[model samples]
Target: MDCEEARFGLYALLDDELEVSKNLEILSHLEGCPTCHRELELDMRVKSLVQAQLAAPAPSPELWNRIVRRIDQEAEVARRPSGGVAKWWPTAAALRMVWGAPAIVLVLSFSLWILHAGQVPSPFVEELVQEHRGSVTRKRGPVDLPATDPAEIVRHFRAEVPPSSPVPLLAQEGARLVGGSLCHVGEAKGLRFTYEVGLGRIVSLFQMPRPTRALPFWPRLGPRYIAQSQGPGVLVWGDARFLYGLVGELPQEDLQRLASRMKGI
Candidate 1:
């Protein structure tokens, strides 16, 4: 399979939505072509970020049906005429009086508010969970910059990231740095460090410059903030200059301990 073919199937592959044969074909292509493999990882990261931001409790189907029923009832009431002079009718004058400019303005304002409320932004740490699930658990090869040595990874990131960013060195026993990759936590650019923490588990560490705008639902910088379990455990904490996160299938306590041992937090 070529890169274009692989790109078309990347999301399906990540979601396990494709047939087994087609999945194998794309995996084979990815294994052979580093560029396409990296493309797959990028797709994974982007999908993660989007799912995090867009995730919200959708209005139930029953709720929508109820809304439709209520609207129909209101329309029926508006169309009906009263038995006496005091009764209501859908007269042109009455319609104009009911839906005057002020009423129209109120309806428009309410619609806008609903639109804004439905788009509530999610925390960046959720994105980290998805990033780890996709880039580490789902697929493991073809990092942007591959290096086992901490210093070498540091050198690569120094050139790729800003000067203020200091990459952490993993010091936990049995955990070894696999490589590094460029990733996006929402719209902000970030770096991901891949690590193998033994027993078939992987940990992904993400670091990026602090966002200028406050992210909704993110904890203040100080102690580690542990997010609710979402497939993998996520731990997030930030300093004045940068934000950091760790994602793994390991227990939350283990992940937190791993984060604490890192040279830089």
Candidate 2:
């Protein structure tokens, strides 16, 4: 099976809804393809994590009855003739006024449900994933500012970016600073540092000013925070000044270790 087909059936396979023949084909493909196997593993892990974190409470019967009654009342109102103050208002406008509150509630509840289920990723997570994917998958020779010294990269960033921005030097046994580039996270100016880890593994550290809006969900890993964005693992934390996010195709434990090291600096 091709990667696309395997991915298409991944959800069904995980839920044990696939036919035996199709399941065997996907299994065979996964055994031969490390990328597909890793993707499947990550999906399962994320699913478990979400299930553990979120508790879905059943709606109270009273609340359900109230909602049904409200819907019936609105329908009755719509069927009635225009009268009194509502006579001047258009039918569509009247309907909107009656349904706006429930509509908003439903929208927000759906958004939160999807987010908690790990079905729809946040915008910040999406941005980080795109940036990391571009850096890793690009058919390029080297990064923009190729340098081993973190100090030199900081100096370059200070010259190009905001001088007041804090650029912490990140060092670990299996990782070394390669280069960096100026970037942005939302409207905030930021910097992305690339590191070369063991066996050509590339990791990216993105930093920006602490965003005004807090993330809906980011699990704490010691003093830092860790999240999985699609396939890559992301570790994020902040000091008084800046917010930092590390993205790579590393295990959660490995990413947590890296985040701990970065947090110390």
Candidate 3:
């Protein structure tokens, strides 16, 4: 990766959002290329220091009030009764302004918030999870990522993941080691890992190596975020180099802890 992309990756790696391919790329380069590696190390140091000084708690009630008020104002427009001229148009316009405006504002504001949210990068990962609730209900379709023995799963991953490395997968204790597989990433032709959890939960994970097209920092399509429209609560984040995304509804914190456990959280 070049300096500019490497710089964005450094932050993504620090936040643990870098994609696996990117993770391997930056990390591999760091081993052979000293300059980029050193820069990444420095970025991590700064990221930790900044995170440490974060406010102890979320915004206080007073702050929330101000925030909400400002948001409301940005979305608010006086609605007038359309008694004469094109009666339908006025009501339609009012509805459009009411719903459409807030939706647009929220989308834009969220984009700004996510650009720097660190631990959470993609805003719609949650939306993807919400939509995936249906597939679970059906018991069919979606990529058939079945489970297998951990030993066998390891071999499969090693064969598929280029540069072949050991990607950890420690499902709940007592749970069967099912299996794991590499799936086509998104439109980017990248790759991701999917593990069929105990009985129900399925764990899908991957990292962004680099950005190619004019996709959002967080690549997604239509109802699909990271090219996935259905799945449990999928988590996406990055550090200095790679972008990471995990799909599963298993408790948010649990998922985070699981991810942390897989690598060096």
Taking the candidates one at a time, how many backbone clashes does each contain? 0, 0, 35
lDDT (0-100) at residue 109 of candidate 1?
99
Query: Which tens-of-lDDT digit does each residue in 125-174 have in candidate 2?
Result: 43443465456325431336656588888887787656877776566785
TM-scores for all candidates: the values are 0.46, 0.43, 0.34
Q: List, residue by residue over 113-138, the lDDT tens digit for candidate 1.
A: 96676355324434543455456324
Worst 10 residues of 2 by lDDT: 134-143
* Highest lDDT scorer: 1
Better-scoring candidate (lDDT), 2 or 3:
2
Summing lDDT over every window of 10 consecutive residues in candidate 3, give the lowest-scoring window: 222-231
Model 2, position 87: C-alpha lDDT score: 54
Q: What's model 2's lDDT at 148?
A: 59
Ranking by TM-score: 1, 2, 3
Clashing pairs in 2: none
lDDT (0 to 1) per candidate: 0.73, 0.71, 0.54
Candidate 3, overall lDDT? Answer: 0.54
